[model samples]
Structures are given as structure tokens and as C-alpha cells.
Target: MKLLYLSYLNSFKGLSREVWWLALVTLINRAGTMVIPFLSLYLTQDRGFSLEDVGTIMSCFGLGSLAGTWLGGKLTDRIGYYKVMVWSLFLTGVLFIWLQMLESFYAICSGIFVLMVIADSFRPATYVAMSAYSKHENKTRSVTLIRLAINLGFSAGPAIGGVIIASVGYFGLFWIDGVTCLLAALLLLLVLNPKKAKELDQVKNEAPRSAYSDYPYLLFIGAMVLLGLIFVQYFSTVPLFYSEMRSLSEVGIGLLLAMNGFIIFVFEMPLIKYLETSTLSRTSLMIIGLAMTTFSFFFLTIGTWTGLLVIGMILMTLGEMITFPFSSAFAMDRSRSGRQGEYMALYNIAFSISHIFAHNGGMVSIANFGYKSTWYLAMIIGVMGILLLYALRYRLQTSRKK
Candidate 1:
């Protein structure tokens, strides 16, 4: 029986030791992301801030991420992934500790901006590491595994965070998050070193390509930005809608969000494999995903947690599972060997841009139009995403046939 168990482990052996280490590092880093899932609530409930203030603060984080994504990408190309990952992880840990000490709202907002910049800047390093470390045949699976690690951490973090917030308070959550980040940094510093470190200097000296030069890549990035705009509402407005508007408990809200992560964990891999062979192109999957996500919001307009709400959440997760990884894989496939960092960096930019719109515009929509109307607006955006994907599909197909 023990031999059988060991054999099972060896059968799924595409992940190298370095890749496993990176996954562990990702898990630890993401465990600290407990702060993000509940950040809006923390700002409003614990910190005694208004929704607008929360939106502004969150937008600052997004703005920082915008800069970080670009810088991290550029640096990854210049210095290689190892040094960038080590420093980024350590600096992000330091920022988290500093964030826990701030009492003033303005200070917290500023800290958030700086923290996001440092934290997000690490992503390109991580992705570049994954791209470099994994074999071509395993690339999609490797990226999915990395995301799986993140979602698994997310799954545990928020559920535990909710309990901690209810029992020991937000400071306890912050302390736990800080410790996890520190531990993650230490692990990365110890175990992983890029094999291509010697080539970094030569690569850095090479002329840079304009981000605009890759129009297809830019289109995909634009699609992701649109997706992020719609998706950010899950973090920003969904909790508010459930708690303030629909009158659900915090625990209930936490469970709903947890369900989202859990679904991703359970289905993402199998779904990815199934979709990999399907005639449905990446663009088509994205359109379907976005349409499902948009339609999911329609039930929210009714202000009831009927079976429809559960179904909507499932659809949203399914859409996400299809779109997000495929988008990343597509970008990586199109990128030049040395410019992987730049391509992934541009890809990460979508999330930051989305956060900016979602927090700022989403909050305003909720305040003025109420939860139902705001969902409708999100649905409209999702529809636009569908149209955008359809338009891009022809371009993608044409490129592939060449």
C-alpha cells in the first residue's frame, strides 16, 4: 500500500524540485493575501472608513501594482528571476510589517500603495521563473499548478482570517500574514536559484521591445483588463452587496467567497485539460466565461440568495478557470525567449488596471445606482468583453494558421 502511494506521487512528476519550491513559495506568499480578500471590509468596519475612502485606498494599491508590474517585468529581464524574487519577497514582507503598524487612514492608504507595488512587482519574477524552469510540454500544467497553490492558500487564508477577525481581531490577521510572508521569503532565499543567472547581464543589455509592437498580445492584455474590471467586483462590491445590501452575515459572505476559491481548486485542472483539446478557441472560452459571468450578475439584481446565486458563482468560477490560465498561456506562447518577463509583465498590468476601474467606478456605481443596478452595469461590461473577445478571435485564428 505504501509502495502504491509512492508510485502515485511519482506518476504526477512533471513538477521539478525547483518548481515545487516555487509552488511552496507561492503558497506561503498567497497565505498572506488574507488581507486582500477582506481589505474592503477591514477598511470600512474595522478602520471606520467610508466606502469612497475604501475605494480610493484600494485604487492606490492598484496604481502601485501598475508600476510594479512594469518594473518587475523589466527587472526580471535584466537581473534574472532569482535575485528579483528574493528581494521582492523580502521587501514585501517588510512592507507588510510596516502596514500593520499604521493607525491613520492616510498612512494606511499610502502604505497600501507602496506595499502593492512591492508585492505585485514579484509576480513577473515568479512567472519568468516558472517559464524558465519548466519544460515546454509541461508549461501549461506548471502555470496551472502555481495558480492552484495560490488558490489553495487563498482558500485557507480567508476562512481562517474570518475566524481570526471574529475572535482575535484584524491585528491578529495582520500578524499572521506578516509571519507567513517572512517565512515565504526565507524559503525562496534558501532553496531556489535560477540556472540562467549568468546570462541576465547580456539579456539586460539587449534592446527592449515596445509594449505596443505586439498588437495581438496587447489585444489579449486588453481582454484581460476587461475581465479584471468585471472580476474585481467579486472583491469590491460582492461583499458589500451581500452584507450591506442583501443583509447577509459576514460568515455567509466568507463562505460564498470561499466557495469561489474551492471551485477553482477542484475544477481548474481537469477543466483546463478538457478545454485544451476542444475546438473552442481561447477567445471563445473567454467569451463564454465572460458571458456566464455577466449573466450571473443578473440574479444579483433580484437581491436573493436563491439557487440561482450559487449557480451564478459556479459559472463565474468556470469562466475564470477557462479564461485566466488560457490567457497567460497564450501570452507566454507568443513571447520571444528572452522577453518572457516583459510579456508576463504586460499581462499582469491588466489586473492592476482592472482594480483601478473596479474600485473607483464600481464603488461609485453601487453608491449611486444601488446594488442591483451596479450588477447590471457589470453585466454590461461583461457583454462588452464578449464582443471584444469575438473580434480578437479572428485575429488569433489568422495568426495561428500562419
Candidate 2:
């Protein structure tokens, strides 16, 4: 009944057409993202690889993703966001085709690394483009809209993916994903060409300095890494634990993951609007979110009950809803103008580190310590993130006032 809550629905009214176009492109791309969520299963069950190998291979994807964002930022500053997105999209599709052909372990790892580098380059540019296209007042809502698209797409993706894995096997996922990545590129080409958003975007003429020069931004990046490390376990670790330890089937795992996106799709925007209308600061919001994230993991310490997972996922979804968009908005606000792409790229380093450690360490944790211990670790890290963000409130408040 509350699916069409008026406040959240109203949040969309003032956003620009270009922002919606960007979101449409994201929805298209994410809707096809079947390969990642089920990759651990495909690697272990199909390819006959060990969990250690799977973790290492997934880390390669993380490394490539890291390189892509850095390169995308550099390219965006030089050649522009449009061309950067176009090539990134087109190339990622082509690589997915190439990825399916490679059979050897090393070849698959190397290919996945390359494919991810090409694909993930799209992220920072999208962030840069979204910032450029939205009015300053609508920035948070605009970013939230894009995330809404992403989560909805994700909700559809895994449900469809669950079916695909049963019928056509893992190969279908790559082809479908590749084709849709190209389609998204086409959408970007037609709608987000050189003719758009010249005025709304900040004019970037000056040569940029290193992001390291901003001490507070560096601190922000650290906090971001901590947060990512905590949440990312939901992706790789949670799936593995459910499938291997709890003996849940692939469909069950998919539904659990899909539930995360569904919760975000339904609730995040209204909650964010509520936070905005109140006196809650971005730092305070992140603190509350991290606290929720920590609490979610605590539920996992109970035996692997389906009821507990539903509760845990809802809490984590709420936490993700509050934390991510505002953090991105805060990143844009914190950046010294004209270097938004570079700043966002630096911001994404948190994701890169989390990918490496969460997968690598998480796999190891699951192999050795068991599920309860891993959940305990996530809870501990979440608590640490909350404390760190609370201490950084002064820096964040000062940036907002400027």
C-alpha cells in the first residue's frame, strides 16, 4: 500500500531530463548484470576451481575496476565524459564476448581483469555526468534516483539470472549482459551527446592538483573504504555462506540477494527525504547508517535461519540506502571545483580496497573460521566505521558551510 509514498514520489519532480536519461542508461546496464552475483558459483561448481582461486580471480576484477576508474577520470578531464562513456560501454560488451571463449584458469582470470577494467571505467564518468546534469539543489535526489534505477535493475537481474542459470547455464548471462551493455551505450550516445548539459555542468578549465592535497578528502576515502569493506561482505561472503554452509540452493541465494535491491528500491528515497527535511547532517546520517549496518551483521551471529536473513537484509538495505548516495553527494560537495571526476575516482578507491580484502579475506575467513566469526568481523568493522565518521563530523560540517 505504501509503495507509492507521496514524499518519495515527489522527490522526482524537479530533476532534469538529462538526469533521467543517465538513470535510464544505468537501469539498462544494471538490469543485465547477472554475471557477478553468480560468479562464485560458476567458478566453483562449474569450472571446478577452488575457493582460493575464485577469490584471487575476483580480486583481479577488483584490480581492473580500480585501474578503470582512475583512467576514466583522467580521460574525462581530457577528452570529456561523453567519449569516455561511449568507448567504455562499447569495449566492455566486446570483452564479455571474448571472456566467454577463454577456457584456461589463467586466461579466464586475465580476461576477467581486462573486461572489468573496461567496464567499470563507466562508473566515475556516470557520477561526473550525473553531477554535471543535475541542478545543485536537486543533486542528492538526482543521485538517489540513479541508485534507485540501479537497485531496481539489480532486483530484476538476479531473478532473471536465477532462471537463466537453470536453463541455458552461465553462458547466457554473459551474452545478455554484453548485449545490454551495448544497448546502454547506444542510449547514452543518442541522448547524452555533445549537445547536452553544457551550462548546468561546471566549466572545467584549470589544470588539477592531486586529491591527496585535501587532507579531509583523504580521511573521507578511508571512511569510505571501511564502509565498503563492511557491506561488500554481503555480496561475496554472504552468498558463499548460504550456498556452501547453509545448503541453500542457487535460487534461494538469488532471492536473498534480490531482496536487498528490492528493499532499497521501495524505501530509500522516502527515508532520505525524511533525513533531509530534518536537521540531520550528512556525517550524522552516515553514522546512523553504519550503526544499522553493524547491527544487521549482529543478527547473522544467530544460526542461519531464513527469518534472520530477511531481517538482516532489510537492516543492511536501509543502511545502504542512507549511506551511499549522500556519501557521493558529500564527495561532490567536498571536491574543489573542476576536478569532480578525479575526486570521485579517488572516492572509489574505497570500493577497490574492499573488493580485494573482502573477497580475499572473506573467502579465507569462511574456509577457516566459519560463518559466525566472519559476521562478527563485519560487525566489528562496521562499528569502527561509525566511530571514524563521528570523529570526522567537524571536517564535514566545515566543508558544508563553505
Candidate 3:
């Protein structure tokens, strides 16, 4: 037992204090994300809103996220990561508190829209700080560790949310989520104030800006937007699929999500080490992950057993483990120094846009083509993404030889 404890302590010996603080802050923030996965259910079931109304509200959030992504990146470059994060957290907490008090559909929609903007603004700032802090050797690991922290919180948050909702309902969940946000903000302010001299220098060295510019960056942003649309089905449709099949209880779904977190926490570090030696680039891993996620949906359509669902969830988690870090790392690598915040913000837009598309598309697809067909559609998108990556690989290889 002593040996085990010492081994665990030794494992974290090489991580910087900043990384540790960031990881802790992420955990605090994610613990509050218990509200996200179940937000749709809360709106429809408890708050007495229609599915269409829920979609409308979420779409509003997506729109806000679109603006927030650009704003976040720009702000991070101008004001620094610490400042942006502080305000983002404080505003997000206030918004969550406001959300708890809302009664009407319009009020809920408006409140959530504003909250999403504030909540999302922190994303690019956090990523920029992480990228700036990491060395090339440990960059992937650093990003993966951050992801691991998120998965850890994600693992617990929903299960806790389930119990809270069952016992005290949606308002309780909101209250807890708001309180955690404030705590996370405080932690960020106290513990993670890394230097930003390099970031400031990068901004000063950039060329004069054109209002009509940002086109090349926008192209990558567009691709990420499509990718987000394809990926959002996992959160929005997958659970609904399982629920419809009557294969898992609410607690069971929470457990499955927790399993995803555990897999990442336990395996991501070693997996990153192994992949580092492989010929595969970050883009290649993303393609592979997408393919696996697409394939998992097929299993979902065919099997209703708990065991099969678990297997499918494992595959999806594996895909997530591969794609998320690689995508973030690759996006950061492509970004210019001063523009890191904007690049990361663009990357986040993909997620927001995808969420809206998936919710709307999934509903239509499920109604018309059934759940199996919806999975097939996701498979098709995965294929397209793979093809795009392959084309990119060829272009890169050809250019290198020249």
C-alpha cells in the first residue's frame, strides 16, 4: 500500500505547478457541467417546454457561441489569459444563477444564450495558456492531461446530477453548478497566474489587420464547424437512442459516461506516449478516431443489451481520446502566436455548431429514417472526414518531398 502511494506520487513529479493548478481548476469547472448533458431534459420534462422550444433555445446558445469564439480569442490576445478567464468564470456563474430563476421559455432561452457566450469565452483563453506553458516534448501530454481532468469531472458530474435531480430536481442542479463555477473562478485567480510576456510580444509583431481579412483562418474554422456538427450526435442522440431501446436506466447512462472518463484518465497518458513514436500525425489520429466513433453508432443501432452498449461506449471513448487532444494540438500548432486565442476559439465553434445541427438533425432523422439510419448518416460523415484527412496527408507528403 505504501509502495502504491509512493508510485502515484512519483508519477506526478514532473508536472509543473501551473499544469496542476489548471487541472484542478478544470475539475472544479467540469463538476458544474453536470447541468449540460441534462439541460435538454430539464427544459422539456421539468420546465414544461416543447422539444422544438428546447432546440430553439440551444440554437440561440450556438449563435452566441459563434460570436463568443471569435471574441474569446481576440480578448485573450489583447487582455491575457488570466484576465479573460477571471471575467469569463465570474460572468458564467452569474448567468447560471440567473438561469435558475427563469420561468418563461423566452427568459430561459435568453439567459442561457448569454451564459453560453460567457462560458465559452474561457475555452480559447484556457487553451492558449496551456499551449504557451507546454514544451514541445510534453505538449500532447499537457493537452491530454487537461482533457483527462475534464473527463474526470464529466464522469462524476452527471452521476451526481442524476441523484440531485431525482431528489431535489433541476433547480438544485443549477444552484450547485453555479456555486461550482464561482469556486473554479476563485481557484483560477489564486493559483494559475502564469506569465504572458511571450503572448504580448507575438501580438506586437503581427502585421496590420484588415477588417475583411481572416479568410484563411476562416476556412479551417469552417471545416471544424462541420466536424463539430458530425460529432455532436454522441451527446444529443446516443443517450436518446439507448433510452428508446430501453437498454439502460438514467443511472446506467450516467455510469456509462463515467466509464468514458475512467478510460481517459487511466489510459490517455500511456496512449499518448505510444502514439508519439508512431508515423501517424495528429491529423491521422483524428481520422482514425472519427472512424471508430462512426462505427460505434452501428453497434448502437443493432444491439440493445447493456453489455453491447458498454462496448460501443468504450469505442466512442477511445475515439474521443484520440481525436480531442490531436485536434486541439493540431489547431494550436497551425495558429500564429498572437492569434492562438482566435484559433482555439474557432476550433470551439465547431462544437457549438455541431450541437445545434445534431439536435435538429437527429430529431428529424429519428422520426423519418429511424435510429439505425441516423447512425448510418453519422458513419457517412466520418467517411467524408477521413477522405478529407487523406487528401490533406497526400498534399503534405508531396510538399515535403519538394
Could you tell me how far off, in angstroms, the CA of residue 355 lies in candidate 3 after the best superposition?
0.8
Ranked by TM-score, the better of candidates 2 and 3 is: 2
**Poorest 10 consecutive residues of model 1 by lDDT?**
196-205
- What is the lDDT for 349 in model 1? 84
Clashes of 1: 0
Off by over 4 Å in 2: 1-5, 38-55, 162-172, 197-199, 203-207, 239-256, 302-309, 336-338, 366-371, 397-402
Clashes of each: 0, 0, 2
The Cα local distance difference test for each model comes to 0.77, 0.82, 0.75
The model with the greatest lDDT is 2
Model 3 clash tally, residue pairs = 2
**Model 3 ranges off by over 4 Å:** 1-13, 41-47, 162-172, 194-205, 208-227, 243-256, 300-310
Q: Indicate which candidate wins on TM-score.
A: 2
Q: Relative to the unseen true structure, what is the C-alpha lDDT of residue 220 in candidate 3, on a scale of 0 to 100?
A: 43
lDDT of 2 by residue, 1-402 (tens): 465666667867878889998899999888877788898898898888998898788878888989988888778777777888889989988887668788888998999888888887788888888888877777788889999898778777888999998999998988988898899989888988877544475755476666768777777788889899889888878888777767889999879887886777777777776677778878888888878888998877787677887788889988888899889888877654547678878887678878777766887887898888988888888888877787689776777799
